[model samples]
Target chain A: MRTWTWLHKWSSLVCTLFMLLLCLTGLPLIFHHEIGELLGTEAHAPEMAADAPRVSLDRVMEVARARHPGKGGMFASQERDDDRVWYVTLSDTPTSETDLKQVAVDARSGEILTEPQLDNGFMYIMFSLHVNLFAGLPGMLFLGFMGLLLLVSLVSGAVLYAPFMRKLEFGSVRRERSPRVKWLDLHNLLGIVTLVWFFVVGFTGVLNTGADLLVQHWQNNQLAQMVAPYRGQPPLTRLGSLEAAVSAARAARPDMAVSFVAFPGTSFSSPHHYGIFMHGDSALTSRLLVPVLVDATTAQVTDTRELPWYFSALLISRPLHFGDYGGRPMQIIWALLDVLTIIVLVSGLYLWLRKHRAGAAKEAA
Target chain B: MSARRPLPHHGGRAHRHGRAHRHRPLWRWPVRLGVVTLVGLLSALLADGFWDVVSWLALGALVAVCVFFGWLRRG
Candidate 1:
């Protein structure tokens, strides 16, 4: 019991502040799409006839590239609910992760809608703080370590709960008692209540932090094998038609819709192929992606395969962490739970401080 | 705020009432709530509509329990 108490105190102290920041930032991020629409930054394609002749993906790419004169296309994707607009991301180089810009193009009319800001906005700030604290990969790993601490704290806290609650009934907050006692009961109640939730979200968050590493592994293993034939070939100077490549991918996976296409030389694609990711229409499978590699020069489907277990786990972890899976009600519940979590963190900190102060007072006397 | 103050004793009070008021097993309620919470978290992710509703209710039960204990009920 003493060891558990020591572990719980130290672990919770280490990660409490970061966890608080994450909960606060994550609250707003739960409604990111809604907030974006309200801010008028989200581009919506004008309504067109159901059977309207859609413009080719090539035309969409052209229009997006035209907006950013010298930038190379990195990715093109559409939202799951709205296929009317294609958002094309362009960077200085195909593989550059920074200084990227997005241009939204109407899929039917091939008209540029808006250049959505990739950085510097309310949601972006929240996202940066929540995801990586604006410090990129190192920051992400740091938070992941904090998340690990949070798990340790939670487990130790649970073990300690058995001792604390051995006498008191469940959820018995003796409010008439001292503030510390009230908060201690509240903490134990809310902590145990939110235990499973915090664990799921926290565990998935840890998994998501390893996303970049997992993708690199996939690139080295599966992607390298898929494009082995073109290992020594020079990068394609001129690419084949984007429309043809997409069409071939669609033909290859007739049951799935294209989620996004990673252009050649991007981190998500090899130098010789267009990594067109596809998704199923179901609620569950939509979160799981299947990658189809098409030859960038020939517009031919080179290889299509299911992602490895780790990659699929990373992909699934995204929605679980984001709380975007079950629609508006789920998002609201997620926010409420986040508020409750904030309470837990604050109360825990208070309990620790009060204990420390009392211990000091005792020594002084 | 005396550092040596006796911890608030609820077990004696419950025992004075009757055997019925005796504390339940320590892990009983926590385990039940944990299972409900686990169901709530996964149901929505697996499917929608009825499952989502199930998830909302299951999770909402925890919130409801918190409200009942923290605010509604008094010792």
Candidate 2:
């Protein structure tokens, strides 16, 4: 018990300030899309017939290539909520990450609607801060480590809660007691109530930090094996029909919809095959995606497989952290939980500093 | 502000009313439920259409937690 107390105290002290920053930044991020739309930077697809015959995927690729001139299509993804639009991303090279651009294409007409203005504005600033503290991977990893400390603190705090509340009730907030006691009760009640939320978000948040590492692993392992047969083959100058490739992938995974497609030589695809990522329509299955490999030169379906468990976990963690999956209501719930977390952090800090001050005064006496 | 102060008597902290309710369930089970709720809510994000039940359940649980805290605060 003493060890648990020490753990809780030090762990909370170490990461309270950082967690406060995350909770603050994450609040606005929960509504970033709505905020973006209000800011007039939202890219909307032109309304079309609900059952209209859409243009071919190959035509969409052609339009994207024409718009970018020398660049190549890295990825194309349909909007999850709106089927009318498809986002096509292009870069200087298919594999390049820097200066990458995206175009929202009218799925029916194959015309560029608007270039989504992202990675700027106040939301972007908040996103960067919440994500990496403007320090990129190292910053993300540091926060992930802090998240670990937060988990330790939560566990330790829970351990202490039993003893502290042994003689008291579960949710007791002693308003008549010292201010610190009142805050402590409030903190414990809120913390325990939101324990599941804070832990899940923090855990998944840490998993998301491994996103770059996961992509790197997929590139070296699974992608390497899938494209091994074409090792000596030169990159195809004239790509086969994306429409045919997509059809072949659809044939492979009939129940699932094509969520995104990574063209040859892109980060998500190999040099010889197009990565057709298919996903289920259900809320749970939607997060799990399976990639189908199609021969770029022949547009022939090669192989399809469910991603390894860890990678699938990473896929699930993304939306879990963002709280955008269940619509506005879920985000609202997430925001409320975030507020509770803020109270926990602040009260924990206050308790520690107050304890230190009391100890110092006693020493002087 | 003393750590040595006695526990509160009113509100959510007053669990010592009856002798019958004093049974101590293992802390491991509550800890386990916390873990399940955590995973359930997170996995809720992946759901859509008919699978929205999980998401809804997760939301309901969170809402309940908030309401409980509100009641505690009010008391």
Single-chain TM-score of chain A, each candidate: 0.98, 0.94
Q: Write the per-residue lDDT of candidate 2 for residues B1-75, one digit (tens) a residue.
A: 123323445545363542214434424434554765665575556445544556666655755765565354564
Model 1 residue B36 CA deviation in Å: 1.4
Which regions of candidate 2 fall more than 4 Å away from where they truly are?
A: B1-75
TM-score of 1: 0.93
DockQ of each: 0.35, 0.29
> What lDDT tens digits, residue by residue, belong to model 1 across residues A2-46?
788889999999999999999999998999888989999889888
User: Model 1 off-target regions past 4 Å?
Assistant: B1-24
* Candidate 1 lDDT tens digits, B9-72: 5588655554333334667788899999888888887887899898888888888888788778
Sorted into a CAPRI-style docking class, model 2 comes out as acceptable
- Encode model 2's per-residue lDDT on A268-353: one tens digit a residue: 78888899999887776877889999998788888787888878879878887888787766778779878878988898888888
Residue pairs in collision within model 1 = none
